[model samples]
Target chain A: MKLFKDAGHLFRLAGVFLLGTLSFLAIRAFVVPHSFGQYGHYRGAAIAEIAAHPVHFAGHQTCETCHSDIAQTKSAGKHAQVNCEACHGPLAKHADDPSIDPGKPDVAVLCVRCHSASAARPKDFPQVDADQHSGGIPCTTCHQPHNPVIAAGGAK
Target chain B: MPGVEGFMYPNEISLYWSVLIVLYPFITGLVAGAFILASLERVFRVEAVRPTYRLALLTALAFLLVAPLPLQLHLGHPERSLEMYMTPHRTSAMAMFGFVYLWYLMAVLTVEIWLDYRADIVALSNSTTGWRRWLYRILTLGSQNVSERALHIDERVGWLITLIGIPSAFLLHGYVGFIFGSIKANPWWSSPLMPVVFIFSAMVSGIAAVMLLYMVLMRLRRQPIDMSCVDTIAQYLLYIFIIDFSLEMLDLIHRIYEADESFRSLDFMVHTRLWLSQVVLQICIGTLTPILLLFLVQVTKLSVPVRKRIYVVSGSLALIGIFAMRWNVVIGGQLFSKSFLGYTTYKMALATREGLLVSIALTILPLVILWVLVKLLPPWPEKRHAPLPAALAAD
Candidate 1:
């Protein structure tokens, strides 16, 4: 009580610190099951129910087996640093239901979640405004999911 | 598709946020302009502008206070912005913005206002009680002694500060131009004349802002219209606007003459990316129209009523013009891809915290600061028993 009263208007600082500490602890507490596969049976059961297959898709090697062109394009594009599933979400379904209609994810949402508020992004990289992009140009018009490079990165 | 040599030399155009960062000085230009309008009356004995002088100073100071907010919003971690001060580097022009902001705030605006209103402070100090008294007391800085000699000294010091601040004003806004101009990467932004163009435009915007606010304040207070003051302000606005327009034309001429490899791309960006802001709003509506109206009023010896109306239209246009210029420099620069082959648009979302809300906050923060400043040192002198004669009042 004394500390709270003396804190005056420093409540924001205290709250940020408290939230950070709690998040750290929560991450640590949840890590045990994730690393050990202690709940592997439940996870497999859930995956089977949802995706109808539990085959592990280990990175690009799993992706290249089926779609070599996209893999090659991905490697050549600016998105080489990113994994296919990073944007495509879980690809387990794509492998399982051959007729699941793998329509693209809303590209604007996937891109702007990082690009607009980005810090270390390259200079002259276009910023996506929610209202404008939501209105006129759709995401795929400017960006390609399989291949996203600004003129093949030769654009100094 | 694999091989290409048409790829431009020195390719990195600018950072996404660097464009927005440039807008900081553009806003500061408005501040410098408004402050100079005030100085014309306060320090330079331009009695015809006395009506709007105090209001102009307040407006300048108000905008100056908030000029950094947009830059802060553009930054990834605004909290880390203070590091610019702790870790100042010589090569980075932006690293010096902190110093420029401080010099303008502390040495220019704060000191100028306080010194200019010392006479009023001593009077207000004795009249108010409690917190107001304490506020006035602190503002006075233990100087209750406002004798004839002290008043004279204050005036002298105020004049000196105003003189010194002119270059600082130039630096504050001009340095922003320097940042853009210094960039060898973007042929669009890179120009030796960018600073000159920015400074003149700052003057234009500043004058227009003061003219508008002065008219508004008088209407609110129900004070009689000061035609002489308005006319004088209008004249100064015309001068600055003419110079600013000329400089812009010069910049365009140079670009046309050079016709470098990047010309086609830049010209395309200007037409498409900045068409509305640069051509329609800035050039046609804001500049030419205002200049035409001002010329009609000043040259034709129009009626007082007609001139006043013209001032209203012209001043508003000038203000809008300056803002459009800023938008062109800040938002427009980022539209063109470094590849110079493609262009993109910036979309501002309405519902987000970082969108228009932060801009509103930036605009509002200055008014709050002004209110606090006026509370600390009322810009106008309090009506007193031994007030100076009406003749001296003209001073």
Candidate 2:
């Protein structure tokens, strides 16, 4: 007790620090999700939450149902492996109602997303210097949408 | 693409980090630098800088409080930032920021400050009445004992905390640089020297800031400026500035000599897009001018008035140069495409979330907080010389 004589201030400060540390631990426990660190550092619930979102991309088979002509043409062209929704975006709603039009995809801007020349891309991958290849003209101007290599004139 | 030049990757058109991101390192650098300046007086026993010791600590505290604001503002979901504390990724350099920040703020800066100011707070609490008395009393944390023995304990503990603080300050800013330097993909930022460069530059800016603040505050208080303090601070600033500039040049010269694949791209960027900010503002007006001015004062037998003028000019420029350095690091790193064939432009918006307005406000916010802190704790030890407000004078 004699050692603590003038160090009462330190004891009081220590009490405050102890109170703060405990409070922080309590708050951290309360705020942290129950499933956090279940699998790793992130919340386990996040994976399931993300997976629960409604499916948006109607598969190639669904598009092949009605547009067999385009599918047949694409099957023979350079884009045989490419899916309808890959370029067109999510068309599940359009598939639900054919009358609901999925407007023309901007080939000018959209084509460069994949075709832009970069050293990182695979050597075999069909890439181009977008500016040099097309200038200001759209990709659809020279290449067909359904059969790109076939060159079916410009866009309608 | 409108503001962009050359052949930027489609994804590289828009810059991810904005001006707000630039402020993060700048603010934290100030905090680190200021604490280091304060530590010189405490641990290193540099009595010449004793005049600005408390001011430097308070400046560090003020800036440290605002360091995370820019990062929080930059986040799409500011609320999720708390998750960094809850579940920090071990492998991530950035996610570890929360822990580093907390440790520096809570353990080092605040503790050191409280220990150093414990006696003063106790004295103020007993001497004053009304709201101020209540405020100081609370700040004392019921530690009313300020006996000679207790004072000795405070001084000893304060010195020890500062000794710990020196390395902690280095870690704080060096970690900021690591966030950029460790990113292997970005050659502009990826360098082993990044952390060292950041630490030295931080010291330069921090010392300059405290010096300016001390001068201006003293002038405002109608007290005679501490010429010896400013002169010593200026000398240190010059030495540190030379180191910072040399580190930057070394990085540049190494890149030139090596002429790596990314070198051509980064070089072109420096000559073109970064011409104004990097070369003009940061190196010329901001860095070289201040260093030269400080050097001149050091070599020449200048009068007090002339030296004061030189200090003000150089200090302001030093702060500007440091801000420009941060800008170049953050913005310049993002400008060049990873493909090494393209460049993009940063279009800073106004009145938006991460806009120029917000950045300006965030920059000013720390100064405002410093003002309030100055009023509350009175970092000025010579309080009798300070010009008080009517109500405060009465109290």
Candidate 3:
């Protein structure tokens, strides 16, 4: 009788533990406040953070020192709004070595992050796609980096 | 003149009271329309509409509860939107909304529903135990007696409340339409027929909802549906849909006849940008199809199965069509540029908690409320054994 009672108590304890674990899992999956998606949800501050802390991502400035012409055009264009890490993903090893070249990331996916109509961006913004944008001109040719528009004064 | 650049579509209009403001009345119109249907049976003793009366009231309440959510979401500072009430600003049309909401919820609907169900609540309280017993008792409000006198008093009070509620319902939804109609800035929303159009369409949607719900509920319970009850509801739905569709056509006619300076741009928008939504979906699929189906069912003297199928299909169409109408009026109107030169597109994002997910949750919340309401009040009166129909037995 003592052994039977002990077994019953152990079963109840197991039931309680199982209930707790299930509840925790549900809350984590459905209700918890975790940031979501990479489209419009990416804050400008994250871009600024990447800009301010160049040492963290193999310093775009170091590349600028060696490759001035490409860097100048890139800095001037609208692509300036985006950080290299956002488009290329993490690049700690590639940043450390000058000899190893990391090829351009998937251009279609990167552009669609902002350009797609259904992408999680501004509501009033118009739909965009590579086909619609390609009028015998590449995105870089028309857009320039960080600056889509050219100012009156150049970097003379 | 050749060298000058002119804006095809202007961006000069202020979006102060925009699309969100327009939806407020559309939703309220549904609430009022549903409540008025409930009043037809509850107050006027319309035996044919008995099945729909309770369902109508609950539908009205459900829509009413969520009416302000869109407006709240639209406001730049939703938290500060409450300041309209605290300051008691007379010029602010939105200030009166809170008072209107409270009066309907507390002074009218709550009282009428309670009085209507007092006897049933008392009975349910006695039959049940545990939390349900306590719930029923509280709902009964300590009224244990189910005597004829008590019921008579309840019926009288319920009637009075319903009478008072009808005008409040009109004001709530009508005011919403009026706000849009009065906006002189947006020519698209500035028609005088806007309020009339809103109220009638609301009626169309409301009557259709009750009919669909009644059919579904009866089927679920394995009970035989009363064809007379359903026919009556369908008949009312047809009447309202005709008026609603006619008013919309009349507005279009008026716009064309007037041929204002904005006519070209507006016409282009209807033909090009909104052709699918306005011409195809709203007119052809939503309104015309349901109206035709309802007409065939009523005029043709069809078989039971055929009529039932038509009624369900028509009701479902009318509900969806009315929602599409609201969407077109709110979102579609905003897509065209004020300059009449260019049109901008709106892209709704997926996976956002504030977007479609919230709307779905709000829409389905009422089902939960209705289920609990049935569990508590049992909308229909209890069935008692009788040798003959009540009307014949009495005679």
Candidate 4:
């Protein structure tokens, strides 16, 4: 009682602070999503949302099913390890309908995305200075993207 | 890849943090530093700085109120930021920001300021009329007791709060440094010395800010500037600036001596891309020039007018230097590729969401808030009509 009389203002201030904190916590409880912490850190529902999106690039096997002749030639050549979609953009629509050709990518632009000279890339990787090596011609005019054997007739 | 000069990871092409991110720490550092300066009088009993104490607190509050706006604006889902408080990931340093910010705002700054101004607020509530009266009454929080005993308790509690506030101030800015420093993936930002350097630099910027505000406000009010107060603040600024510079040099030397793989790349960046903001603006002109000017004032006997001019120039330069430091840290850290083989440019946009125009507005918003706060609080001792309790008034 004596303490309350002497320090009533302090008590009032403490009460106000407590009320503010409680209100903040109550609001937080009301608004926070229920499944937020179910996963490692982020919202678990986010993973499901992402998984529900349609797959864009069909696997290499799907391409081989249609273009077996090109696939066989690619498998026998130096460019065997590279995926079809590495140079070409996603071809889900092309694979869905055979009439859709998905047409050839711009050879210089597509090739340089990976084959451009960079010190950070692996030393043995087939890199080229797009300006010097190609001499303004498209890469496909010299070396086939699918089967690159310079001595052999390119792209059959 | 088109704009890129060398080698950058596909994901590294676009910068995640923008100019507003730079302003976030800069503003928060000012708030922490200003509050720490105010605490010097309250906790450490530095009587010479008492005149600027309330003003410093008001400055801190005004800046603190605006500090989170940048982060909010930068967020993709600003509404979702509340999850940081409700469902914060325990392992993440970013998650702790919400808690640290709340603690500093409510537990330290607001409580300290409310206690310090309680008597004046209660008195104004009684003396004023209409909406102004209601405003003061709300500010008083219904605790209108200004009796000697009650006022004495307020003083004691306010002192204790200041004591707690010193560490809180350190934590607030140091934590910001840790946010950048802890990212081991970025060699430029990864340093244990980052937080210590941030704390000292924060002190330097904060002290300079309050000092300038004191001088300017005094001039505007037609009151003679307090020489002793300005002198003390300048002295503190000089000491802290020296420490900040030393820590930064230490980090530089350590990186140079080690000469790790990242060193060559970072060294090249510092020379080529970051030369202007980092070396010339931040180090040479902004830092060394101000330090030299402040050092001269300390050593030599200059005229009052000359000393005042020097303080203004150095304080302004110190602010520029600190802002440049933040820019170099946040923006420069992003310019170099993670592979350390190439560099990219920050093409600052004109009117976009996180662009140059928005950054300038964010920077000025704090001062406008300070102006409003000054009018409302009237931090000057003479501005308040309600007399201090007889005991404190005697002091």
> Which one wins on TM-score?
2
Clashing pairs in 2: none
DockQ of each: 0.02, 0.43, 0.02, 0.38
Model 1 stretches with alpha carbons more than 4 Å out: A1-156, B1-15, B18-23, B381-395
Kindly indicate the candidate among 2 and 3 with the higher DockQ: 2
Q: What is the C-alpha lDDT of each candidate?
A: 0.72, 0.88, 0.69, 0.87
Cα deviation in Å at residue A85, candidate 1?
Answer: 17
**Which tens-of-lDDT digit does each residue in B1-395 have in candidate 1?**
11122332223232355433544665688798887887786567797886666667777888887887777777667766765654455567888878888878877887787766655766777888998888777666665655554555556666788888888888887888888889887777888898889899999988887787677766776876788888888888898899999999998998899899888888987887688889999999999999999988877978877887899999999878887887787777766666767665666545444466656566567778867765564554333312443444455
Q: A1-156, model 4: which lDDT tens digit per residue?
A: 755675787888888989988998888878776677787676778899999999899878999998999898889888799889887779988899879888888976887888898766889988989899978987777687777767767544
How good is model 1 by TM-score? 0.68
Candidate with best lDDT: 2
Positional deviation of residue B89's Cα in model 1 after best superposition, in angstroms: 2.1
Position A96, candidate 2: lDDT: 91
On the 0 to 100 scale, the lDDT of residue B163 in model 1 is 87
User: What does candidate 3's lDDT look like per residue over B1-395, in tens digits?
Assistant: 12112332333222233444445555676678788789877666667987778777877777777778767866657766654444345665667767677778777877677666666676778888999999987665554655554455455556788989888777776776776677788788898898778778888877887788788988998888889888888888898899999999999999999999888888987887678877888888889999999998877889888889999999888877887787777766676666666555544534443456556665676667777666566665343111222333353
For the second chain of model 1, what is the TM-score against the true structure's chain B?
A: 0.90
lDDT (Cα, 0-100) at A24 in candidate 1: 54
The per-candidate count of clashes, in order, stands at 5, 0, 16, 0
